[model samples]
Target: MNEQLTEQQINAAGHLTIGGCDAIELAHKYGTPLVVYDVSRIRDQIRRFKKVFEANQVDYAVSYASKAFAAIAMYQVAAAAGAHIDVVSGGELYTAIKAGFPMDRVSFHGNNKSADELAMAIHHHVGVIMLDNFHETDLLSQLLEENDAKIKVMLRITPGIAAHTNKYIQTGQVDSKFGFDLASGQADEALEKVLANPRMEMLGLHAHIGSQIFELAGFEGVADKLVEVASHWQAKYGYQARVINVGGGFGIRYVSVDHPLMPEEFVDAIIKAIKTAVAKTNLDLPAIWIEPGRSIVGPAGYNLYTVGSRKDVPGLKPYVTVDGGMGDNIRPALYQAEYETVLASNPHAPIEEHVRLAGKYCESGDILSQDQGLPATKPGDVLAMLDTGAYGYAMASNYNRNPRPAVVFAENGHDQLVIERESYADLVHLDRPYEQQ
Candidate 1:
């Protein structure tokens, strides 16, 4: 079976306790379909990333990708850890600011940022703005001219390397909708435009291959390509970038079959590749920056759901339904993601049979897992889906009118509520009465 739970989650007397708090007890108190995060685990991931780069004497900046798990409390954690944050939208930026995160440590990113969004980032004096395309460049230039303000920026580049991962998550390919395509000379054009403009200070270049990437070859290849591009710029325009922001996609173990490199290993491999490429091209070594979202917080989360119904098929696999489904976690439906499901009430119970874990949503595609082994599950048993800390809550929706679940932070055996469960009144809080004549 996959070790989906974090180090803080342990089985004591056949019960699961995450961060020293009993999972089953927490389920009853906080209600089923609750998300509990291990704050210590999150901090540990951050430290590991920083430690690896710092030990190599490389100037580095680690930014938390807030779109993975954006919450006020998560922002506070990143700020407390002295890490930067990557916000792709205005709402996330607002959350980071409301949480008192330093504006100098914030980075704004998006493919199609509007004029208003650019104004918001500039008004807040955000640390960096990752320019995605030509339209944004034109829009930002106009906005800066109007406001008489300057902002640091990076050009997002599509390196044309297809990562060996899901097609849905690949963002660095030449045919992607994200960054300037290098194969078509769009990247060079974008760089030229930014260099000529005086309003925006071009900090460096940024590229993100994809998410849940497991191989080191992809990282090394991306480093090589990016360095080559930088070298081209150096020779053509006598320009040297001070920073190289390679966005993160380090994969975590969601199933037993997945054997991914540790954070240290991933960092070492990428750094070594960049060093070699820079040396070959006789270029300056730029400060490295990474924006990790899932790897930092994925393993630290546990989604607790109460089993509600069981259906037995004559020959096909039996199905066990949980209170939560795609409404709270849409990864399976969207990315065809697989996760390990364990009975929180019986963590160590022997796998008596294999069954289909179905979500309570009305859609047939709401199944979380199929042919997964469980310990003869019962209706009241609490099922804990491991490794949901990344996209679980962030992608949750009110499909089928299902209210989103609450969230809690567990640390030192104490659990604190961070987000309250949505109530029925909240569902209709914006609904209008039907008494209009």
Candidate 2:
């Protein structure tokens, strides 16, 4: 049995279960290449993050980084757990609005936010705008003035802290394109601009080290640097920060080797770091905010696909292909991400072979897992890939003209479809003929 699947997750019939629903039955009902999320896990992760702050007697906000997996149902689930959310584009903001999410709890973030996107945020009265550069600050200032409105603004400081991840995943570096550079006084310049604009309410500072992070040292260093900047700004311009958002990169367990800290453990470490740093200065303790995306929902998501074909070569590992591939989940193809796959019917079965889990995509690099240990499987047998909730469906495309998989939410022994599977009609709905009258 793979250690990832506990005995409790295995039902009496020896079949795997997710959120109290049989994984095999879900495959039959929702069809193969389906994306399912255990709703309870999502809520529990949020509560775990919140309980840490409540126990420590500190103000905090567990903002869901929606770029990981933004959907109407996901937004509703985050809202039900009393969480704030970080929206990076107009589409995400619109999704939040459609979900009836509280506009006041939304923090808009983006590097090259257009004037139209800024106007949409203002019209919606989002909670805060994380100013990424001087152009954004000026454009936001102009938008606020034109709308005759006041909006909370936070300066996103590029703290130059390097979090351990893929080169592309590290966004907190001094040379990154995401936030204002701190070393070159770009952060200070943006702050001065925000302070000069009457319609922009300077609230606090925000910085994200990176994504899928595991070490506490990176967050600790970031916390110290954030407090140091706040103290320096206060001493120079008499400005006090009300919020300090240490953006989330808290990692989650994808494979057996990935040992992620518990949500409470991560939150506790972050809280202690901020408190220790604040104690060194005259500044009041600011509310600590974290934007958790992968940590909150990654573990809860499972991608179920049906085995379709097999390729065997002498003296080489067999290729066990599934019906779905890079089109539905591009992480593996995009960044060589790893995941654990098991037989949906019997996860505890003896491992018959360790084979290459191949996708249906035409790209040779679209392998889901280089090595997956599983029992003997035949065509039509279902396989469930674990921990694919983060950027899977959120980045789904119509590659190879394959219709994307449907999404389902299963909890308390009940299941409901969330995102309907794309149909051939839906794909061609946006097309128009040049010869049309």
TM-score of each: 0.97, 0.99
- The top-ranked prediction according to TM-score is 2
Q: Which candidate is the best by lDDT?
A: 2
Residue range 230-298, candidate 2, lDDT tens digits:
998999878999999999989888899989787568779989999999999999999999999999889
Q: Give per-residue CA lDDT, model 1, range 9-117, as digits (tens).
A: 5655567887788999999999989999989999999999999888878888999998999999999999999899999998899888889999999999999888888
Task: Give the Cα lDDT of each candidate.
Answer: 0.90, 0.92
* Superposed model 1: Cα runs more than 4 Å off: 5-8, 434-437
For model 1, state the Cα shift of residue 374 in Å.
0.6
Error (Å) of candidate 1 at residue 410 is 0.4
